[model samples]
Target: MDSLKDVTLRPWPAPKKEELSQEDLLVKIEQLASERGHLRDITEKSLQEDIDAGKHIPDDTNDAVKQEAKEKEAPSRQERLEKVFNAGKEMYGHLEWAKFAATNALDLLSLVLSQDTNKRNLSTFSQTFREQGLNQGIPFGSFGISKENHEFHNRKPEELQRIQELEHKQKVVAQGARMEALDSAVDEILQAAKQLEKEVRRQTKYWQEIVAVSDQGWPLQRLRQNARHVPFGVRYGLPEAGDHFKARGFAPLQMDKDGSIILDPALALKPKTFRVRVSIDGKITGTSQLEVEVDTKDHSIQKSIQLARDSLFEEELYHEMSLETRQLLAYGVEFRDSVISVDAPLMGSTSHDRKLLIDCIPREDIVADSHHHEHDWLARNVAEALRLLLAHEHSMRLYRRSQSPPPLTARTQEQAPPPLLRTLLAVFRHLEGVDSLYVCLEMVANTLNSAGLEVTLDTTRETSWAILAESLKEPSKRGLSATDQLLEIFRKPFDGRATLTLPTSNGVQFESLTIVTRTIIGQPTFGTEHKLTLPSSLTSDLHLFQQLKFSSVKEVTSYLDWILPLHIAHRLLKSEYSSRATIKSHDSGITISSRECKRGSAFSTDIKVELLEGKLKATALTASPLSETEHTEQSHTWNGGHSSTSFKQVIQNWVG
Candidate 1:
């Protein structure tokens, strides 16, 4: 079995006249003509059979009508048929004459070929042609027939001439008969073709509808371009816009199914001031009122005020430029003092941090006309512009920072970041969760870039500290501590940098966690070449002390002894405001105290813990005052804070 996929077929040859060469073509034509004659004879026989069966015959191949027609026109049709037969008889006579000529010519050729002398007789042949009504009353050759053969054969010249004339007459009659038959056939075919053409024209409309053709037959693509016209549809016009519409311009448009031409609003004239208008079905049906504006450009401040005269409308611009102006500013150009200011109505109780606009215009008279120099105009305008720019920049940065997630939302609905804060929050959501310190820092910088604030951080220091802080707060969150994990992820570059000091609300947190780590000689070791510290504690009041030094790692565990006790003394003195007398301490401590009126609150607190020398001074501290009669002592205990980890550990946990 041959499947469709498995089947293969040979290519077919193109149709060509050479497929039936001229000689073979002639034979096919003769064969078809013979077959046509037989078909005609069979058709006539079929008509006779119908008549015999008493069935009606139709004219033009209708059997029933032809039968009736044959009966009604029987006699006249027979008479006409006989006349046609007589015409055929005449044509047959010409054929007979041609046959006679061929026979006689053959005999003459035989006689001429047998003759010993070059002379022929044509007189008898000429007499025969005259009797057949073929003589032209001229010499043989002059009549386009040759008698010279007879002369060459030594026959009587006149006889040969007569034969030549008869042959010429026969040839002419045969040719005429062929021409008449051909002419009749052509006329019949042309009449039939005319009828067929009429039928084709009648059916063409039906086909055209089926094909979805227009009158002129242009197809769909041409119509989309509005180039070709279709009936039963209106022609759409080119769009023209003016001040009455927004974004005034011209565009090409087409009518929708609703018969309304929807003009693109972007095509409206004077977009800054104009509103859109829609024209439908040869009538303007939309809101027709035009948005009018007094033309002005030099003073945007005045123009903006006039444009937004209503308080409600003006309030929309409370600290920002108009929507239209903002759109215009998007056209790629840098500005030194392009400020957007809004004067919003104050909303009390709600912080205005997120509120967008502020008072924009100059606080004082911008132009002191008569005496003011042009430079003064620029200075005042530029200065006001600069101030606005700086203030907005500052607010924008703060707004940006507030946006960072996990964005703190107010527990009570009373507090929310201002509109700018919300906007910055939105921006920050996009900025947060960035893994790259550079990128996170860049986002921070970019958020403040437009403001006067300059942000600079040593990547080695600030980033490491932030990583360390995050690790301590949420160990499981960023998987910074895992087995061989930091090496598995990012290559740990050698960090020899020292701790950086960045300004904070509290003095400065060590920028590098390594500073504290190395100082404590923690498990995650800073190599010997790196700065290291000793671990020790002095008094019973402090729990721990970390030794610190430069890359010179040595056990100066003595520093812990000096530092811890002094810190403990300060903690103890916080509650002794009543004592003004000086007390001497056993270990190089000079304490000055004044008992001034004994005017401090009296409370009794106690702490109990021991401090061993270079091992661990897990101490606890609690303030105590001389209570009334020194009777009761309240106790307090303390625990140490969480410790730090290395950068490699941080990355391992984070990556994992």
Candidate 2:
């Protein structure tokens, strides 16, 4: 390691002769003594830090090791301070009678160290005991005085004086060694202080230049002007300008006249305000008023807001207006002009079954004749009537067990829904064209009214099944007869049943025969009511069949029918004669060969043959067959040529 180098140190706050007199210098010295103590503390802390950081090696505390360390450590401010004190004390003892060395030394040290500019010079110190040794230098063991043999404590007054003089001289020489460097350091400190002050001022000027440019970062002038048109939001300058201007050594002022806020450097600013604008796609749907206020009371910030209300609900209004207009336009467009698909058979079947799809709109001509209404009313009804007609056709198919019709176009967008009045007119026109159609409809209408049905329009599917069922409840003056007949007569195509009962003089007789059963096969509902209305018919025919109450006791499935008078006579005579007459055994098997028996035959000879199964079979010999046999007998007599003399033979020929 190199030994301590000769380092040049400068004084801080260089001292002036006028500024610090001897008395002031003494006070400064005392403060420097305290500063020395502070520096010593700092040095110790640095030494400890070095030791802890492994920068110092503590092997042993020998005198040689201590000396080596002291030399390695460069002089600090505390050491320089102490040197000044020691030099001043030496001079003070020579001048003053009293011992003012301590006071003087303190004064000189303060003056010197305070003026020092060198940081290295401000960090020095000395051992406390060594300086005391310099105050009293001669060794105590120098006189021949031993602790075991004390001789009047040895005369040492002159020896003490000699010791003090030598010590004082040594102290003086030590203080004089650094005197020239101290003087040079004072001048150096003064020069450096001037330069530092200049640097601080230059930096301040540089910052101010940078802040001036940054203050208008967002064009506050434009922001203020634009804010006037917005109706909302306050405009203010940037909040950071004050801090920035201060850093640059300039005071910034608020630009309140332009509505641009600026933080004042002179006064504490609570907070700054600024303007903002919100827009979408450049369309001005709304304008708002907004205020940003910073309360100086508690530095609280709040924004007040107000927005213009939209008075026109345009979206909903437009949609409603368009829908209504479109509906009206649709009325002019021709609809139902297209047949789509027609199933006449299905419609006919519905008539036969006496069921109409009341929900469906009737054909156009029929609708017009029925109502004679305005076109608009007719249009609405027509749509409904058509739907009902289609539905009736479909229901009839189900009733007759027929194959479903081909799919018709359900969506007729071009057609405005035909009105109810139109359908009624169309139906009336249709009825007028076909007599049978009128009769069918009248009967149905009558039957429906009589059945107490309640008619109501169904709007769901444009077709109404409701009217049919409901209309049936209306009263029918002719009862259900006309409807019953019409439904059955037209039902030939649908295979329906019919029953007829007629009154005889003796009894009431009836017959049920189905001309066509094909139609009713799938139409179970329509045929259900066809069940012999014998009860209803009989009830109506009470006066006509009142005499049948006394007829034969035999139970008859059809009470409406009884045997005729002629038929009854034939039945009685055959029964009586069969019991009394002889049983003529025929050539073949019990054949009645006598012709006299059949003369104006009031009775029928019914020969009943009973098989083993007890099932009786009957054959009747007619009066004409008996007469023919008699004629054959006469012809044989004539052929024999002896019949002229035989009276019996002649009689036989005449009888034949």
Index of the highest-lDDT prediction: 1
TM-score attained by model 1:
0.16
Taking all chains together, each candidate's TM-score versus the true structure is: 0.16, 0.19
lDDT of each residue in 1-656, candidate 1, tens digit only? 22443566875764885476668878866765554433334567876886899655433556566678888876677899997997799669768878888867854553444343343345435355545533445333222223542223466889899999999999999999999999999999999998778656644543344234233332222234553222222111111211222121223333333332333232221222111122222222232122333353342322222232222122222323323233323222112243332211122212432111222332222222233232233224322332333234334444445664454676644422122222222222212211122233333333222221222434343233346545455454233334223211112222323222211222233221123222111124322223323223222334433434543212322342344233333332322322421224443232323222458643322222221232212222223345344333222211122224321222123212
Summarize candidate 2's per-residue lDDT along 1-656 as a digit string, tens digits: 12333456765665465466669888866765564433334566776886799755543544577789889997899999999998788557556634356555543454345343452231231233225532357332222322453334555889989999999999988788678678788878987897777656654543343244345332212234334322122223222222332133222333333333333332232221111111223221221112333342442111110000000111112222223333332222112322111111113233331111111111111222232222233233433333343333323434434445446787753523222222232233222223222233233223222322111211111012223344345523333333333332222322222222222222334322111112121133221111223333333422233222211111221221122111112322223333433444321112232344445543223232211111112223433454544322111111112222332222223333
- The window of 10 residues in a row where model 2 has the poorest summed lDDT is 303-312
